[model samples]
Target chain A: MGSPAPERIVRFSGTVRLAHWLLASTFFVMLFTGMCLYLPALSRLVGRPTAKAWHLWSAIALLVGIAVLLLIGNRRSLTGVVRDADRLDQDDVAWLKGGPRRLFDHDDAPPQGRLNAGQKLNTMVMLGLMVVLAISGTLLWLGERDTTYRFGGSVLTHDLASLAIGFLVMGHLYLALVHPTTRHALRGMVVGDVDRAWAERNHATWAMSESVQSAERNA
Target chain B: MTANAPTPRPGGRPIGRAAFLGTVATGVGSIALLSRYSGSVQAAIQKVSAAVPGVNQIAPTAGWRIYTVADQMPTFNAATFKLKVSGHVANPVTLSWSEVDALATETQVTDFHCVTGWSVDKVHWEGFRARTLIDLVRPAGNARYVTFVSTEAPYVDQLTLAQFTAPGVMVAKKQDGVALKQEHGAPLRLVVPAMYGYKSVKWVGEIRFDAKRADGYWEQNGYDVDAFIGRSNGLTGS
Candidate 1:
């Protein structure tokens, strides 16, 4: 037999992988349907009424889907993501301060826990943008019923939030799918594990501490 | 011969004038016959177009949704109506109903659109082309923007001179071969095929050529000034 398989580290649990895929799929659905509603040419292709129905229904599905997934998924691990992203330790501050240099060389980044400083910012900002979009989108839909909603700047706010979300999502895709060093990051979200060596090099503290293995097994 | 009744050239030779006149008479007779039964033709046209999706939304009685700032359409009278042409024009003359009708009649068959993603296609419109009005009241060299005031006190809109005078832009007096109904902007209304219906001010009472741009009622309330059909409304930003 070949040498024993290289030890694997659980970078993400099954629940986290499912959540990642769920969010990623919904992001595309919203992007494509939102575009249909935004561009007049596309609106004519399927008819405006049809496009509006699809966009509205898809948004509802996404909001409901996330709520249901969180309720059914591993409570500790799922909640841990929020907890980790919320609190910024000294290493996270240093990592954030590292700025542009960290993008070029991962080694310049501090030995962060499971969640990094950049990821924390991305998570917080994305959540804030979603809240803005939900409110503005609801107002825009109500504009047909009353002109008051039209005067509320809901259209401008919805469009601006969508643009910001799209920009951040593109950056996220670049790291997962295109970046040379972080290309393996996709595997953690896909298979719920990463090579022990890759984990040691990128997330030395999380891999060496075996903190994820002990805490996440219970999850 | 009437242009519509011209005979096809045979052996590369022009037809005789008498023969042409005879052909024209026949064409005239055919037109009379068609008009005698035009009711059926109109019914057929309506039947086919109404079957098409997004086409049945312009009926005055049912389809079209009327919006008025004062909760009513401004009353119009052909006899007393006057459209004042003032501001940056060399000739600031007022036109009566007869004077307005005296200008050459131009017609168009194009789609009319509302800002709310609704449209009425192939609407037959008859009016005096904007160019005719431009020639009658020559705007000053410095005049750039055009403003229109509706008979309704609060309903007003503005457009650039180029947009106001573009092809298919007209001071419409008739729609679908019928005098405009009161609800649809009777005596005269502006018809702008290039922009949404809001820019096409109804019950037009005043036309002004000004040097500076002024916001319309909707624009003052946060709507886009240049409301082009697809590219405007702040939906897309460069």
Candidate 2:
């Protein structure tokens, strides 16, 4: 009989998975409600008042969820992502220059850590955008409550940031769902683990490092 | 009156003095009822106008909520209302509604953009150009800014001398083909089409040309002094 298949690698912790889903759900709700408010054609379907309420509540929830995750749920994962995103070594630069084609071609692509170059760039952009959106959205809400609270060009900033985030979300979804090579990536986020073979093939450097650390611990 | 007018046969109808008297009474009674009804209708309309002032003049396309700091609108007699233009000018002048209206008038259909993410497009405004007032006052070379003071509220707004003199800026008196209502600044309100709505002060009573920049009501509260559309306040893209 063939040897038993290798155990799956734990790609995401339980806290990380929980935080990801909460954020995803909140973001989707906000996006839907925001689109209803922004598009005149869709406004009638959802109604402006209802859509506005949902959008505001969802935004608040997203912020709260992020705070909870950072402060209580999984500080280690959050810090790791943030720290790794900031440091782009030569390999990451090479990966970025090689582009997605190189990733798909699988022609000796650069070894990556927990996050690849694309994900690092995405994380940085998303972090900046989230900060902007939070500030702008709060200002907008205050302005709505009282007209006296007029912040200059805040409306434009809110609109532009929201649009950028919307596009980013779409791109992220496509990569995780539609891309042939990355379609199975969603399982890792959902189940918190990835098949050993897949992890070895896609994240060879990370897999090797994890194995070495496990060996050291065992020894 | 004919004393011997034809007498009515059985069921033929009454004639002469009694009939004439009846007809006269009916006519007077109908006239009284009509006048009373018209008076009540007028009163009802006035009550509605008092409750929701300027509801009729608001354009359907004006999609923004009205915002006022003061709970009550400032009361002013249009006939006695005076707009004083003073400070840093060759000639300081005080003009009444008639005098202001007597100057050249222009009508514009433009969008009124509030900094708070809402905009009203195609607002029809009829008023005298700010240039006409500026020409009359003739700001001195030392003047760098223009400050607008509200007549009833503790609100003030400032604009650069260049912005005040720019085209499309005016002291608007009418909106949507009717006289501007009390809630909408009544006699005169400043209109700066290119800038945010706060720069356009409502119920403007004074225009002061200043040598130095002065903070407006919002500007004093952490808002940018120069509220140019999409350009001011470090809101440009990354």
Candidate 3:
């Protein structure tokens, strides 16, 4: 019997993968330093000033990296992800109703686009949270330098955003690394590709569309 | 499920529902334990502060930020330092540092909130209560406000009669069980726990009971005159 065809497909572009990893690292640094700043006991491990410096610098780096990637990297792919996330149809609604169990049982899930319902939801939530964090963090930094630039709500916003994002990140990590079925999804972020069979099963609608476009281009 | 479906490798090791639940449980348990430990540490710090004389709070010095309006901190001669209590009072007195220190001392543990969004909690302030000084030079019925003048800088702030005589408001002489440093308004500084740090003027050289409201340095520069804690300066609901 002949061996099956190679089950591999380009799932993410190089720029997307780079941005993903960069953001992941930056997020971890921010999380650690931010925790240090929030919890007084943890502040003893790394002095408050050092933790503050790390948190501020990492936040700046994250913002710069995001801006650079959007400006110079795969703007098309970024826009596509955003557009796809925004376009949640009946299938996404059905998937949401079926809940996390359907996520584990891929065959039970409704056919999805390039991004799944959960991923779309995550993207939107993270986007909103990032905007809040950025604005609040900037206000806090400004207040630190110039006492006159302070706003009372800035602290509340920054603190709430940090905690919410931290919890969201935990859930994100659990699904990407610990969940029985979705753990393989991390590969798409790391190596920029996923097994074609896995993609066909998980994202059948997107895979079928890609195949039709490829054939049309070839013809 | 497809007949030809490939086995999913979860980072090379399969994690079952029990394992996932276990991980989450452990995480939550660790957090709870850490918080409990933190509470114990806080209690211990408070205990230590209470044991030490002239200390009523236990905020770490590292948490405080030195803020100056003109980017300048002035030095003072402790030997020549005098606290002048005048204006709308029955007896106007000019007392030296020794005389001020000789007054009935009070200790209070309170949170020092800054308008700039940072707070130093559980600060041990040991000094003469504002009521003591107010009583020493009983204010005239017309005296509705009290003005604090900083000796080193051109900074000034005022408080209403009620606010000036409120409980826990004092002129602190020592902080964290030691003499107040110059950077922290050495020899004498006002500690208004119920108001923002800006209203707690450092290097207090004079206290004047006034007939009308007087704007301090910060108030003239757009800050609220009544810098009440969690009330003025947009700190409400925060």
Candidate 4:
């Protein structure tokens, strides 16, 4: 035919995109309600009980959503990302060590795959934050009647975790929306596909070997 | 107009503009001070209020978070303060400060529990029991519920007669042997020790004996009317 018809490559499957958005929405809901609970002035605006209830419910939704995502999500996509994020190659290490220049210049970067070293680190930290937040949040809720949880410093842990996640989310938003080089990658999350050319340029290591990884669940 | 000009109240001191502004500023500043610096700062502010004319502004008091509808808390003249009991009561009476104070009073040490997961332990609250007031008012046979209306408008709560007369319940005027600061619902606030903090209506100006329970401000805003410390509000764990 004309030119071997431009091969369509999918960056992320629909299942992966659904999971990402679900986590993001729940996170934002918790953040909004958490801020209302944290600040007294804000609490007065949106009654404390409302804020407390929303915070609790959203926290529950986040857990349940994660569980459901694990249960029904594409097994290959779920394990593939976690496996890729956990094991960093020499190129990922070198790309991370490239410092601030890595933001604008990917030339010095060792051939990156689906996710870079920075993203891997962010994923790990975010997971850790979720674990602590859930534990501390449960304790604080229980402390309502039994002060034992309060005595164990659940409030402090919850507050610190809140502060950390607040900042981490802001950084994540900046990269996803504002960072010149990384902003282009947001489409991969939004529509679940990206140009193979862009993938080749950004994630050369994965793009070259990506043909074996089909977009559909054929594997 | 003049600094010494007398207010309408018989024994009330005329609060000059400067003093009023100063009080308002202190209250606003105190409210701005976050609860993160709670224990020491709150104690110090309470000490100041104990010695000075209580700032009729909001402030975190002894770990108690203040909630009110008015933009600024209105100060009450204890010398001229009055509690009016009417509605479905057989005896409608407006008791002046002295009359209300003369009723039999008790000081009980109890922990104050807020639904928001904070508790202040062993607070000494001195006040006459709600039963004491109910006895004096003699609510009519038809009156099943009582509404505690706050001086702060749009902020009110309700309690059944039985709930109002519950043991450990009282109309608290003092906390820890000290007259209540404005932010703590000065002059008078209902103390429902068994329930969450919202049930305790602060700055109570009038007590209306009603035939039915009308949800208070918090209740209207989706808060449980019962407001038990652990049992209500969709909470399961004790």
Best by DockQ: 3
**lDDT of model 2 at residue B39?**
30
- Candidate scoring better on lDDT of 2 and 4: 4
Q: Give candidate 1's total backbone clashes.
A: 0
How big is the positional error of residue B100 in model 1, measured in Å on the Cα after superposition? 18
Regions of candidate 1 where Cα sits further than 4 Å from its true position: A1-3, A211-219, B1-238
Q: How far is candidate 1 from the true structure (C-alpha RMSD, Å)?
A: 25.9
Q: iRMS of candidate 3, one decimal?
A: 13.2
Q: What are the runs in model 3 whose C-alpha is more than 4 Å off? A: A1-6, A103-106, A145-149, B1-166, B171-191, B197-226, B230-238
Candidate 1, pairs of clashing residues: none
Best model number under lDDT:
3
Comparing 1 and 4 by lDDT, which wins? Answer: 4
TM-score of each: 0.51, 0.52, 0.59, 0.54
* Residue-level error in angstroms, candidate 2, position B173: 20
Please write out the lDDT profile of model 4 over residues A1-219, one tens digit for every residue. 576754445667666677789889988888887766655446445655676777888878877876787788765675555555565666766777797787777665677777777776667666666766776677667655453333223554465567667788999999999987778788888987676777777787767656544433255
lDDT of 1 by residue, A15-85 (tens): 66777777788778778866655653343344345656677877787778777767886656665565555
Which CAPRI level is candidate 2? incorrect
Poorest lDDT segment (10 consecutive residues) of candidate 2 chain B? B1-10
By TM-score rank, best first, the candidates go 3, 4, 2, 1
Q: Write the per-residue lDDT of candidate 2 for residues B1-238, one digit (tens) a residue.
A: 0101111111211222232344334333423342234334334444564567564232212254444555455666868889899999999999987887788889999878666545666799999876887789898999989889998568899888888878888889898899877667777888998887878898889999999987788776566677776655434422
Error of 1 at A18 (Å): 2.5
TM-scores of the first chain across all predictions? 0.88, 0.91, 0.91, 0.89
**Scored by CA lDDT, what does every candidate get?**
0.68, 0.68, 0.71, 0.70
Of 2 and 3, the candidate ahead on TM-score is 3
TM-score of 4: 0.54
Quality of model 3 by C-alpha lDDT? 0.71
The predictions' CA RMSDs to the true structure, in order, are 25.9, 30.9, 11.5, 19.2
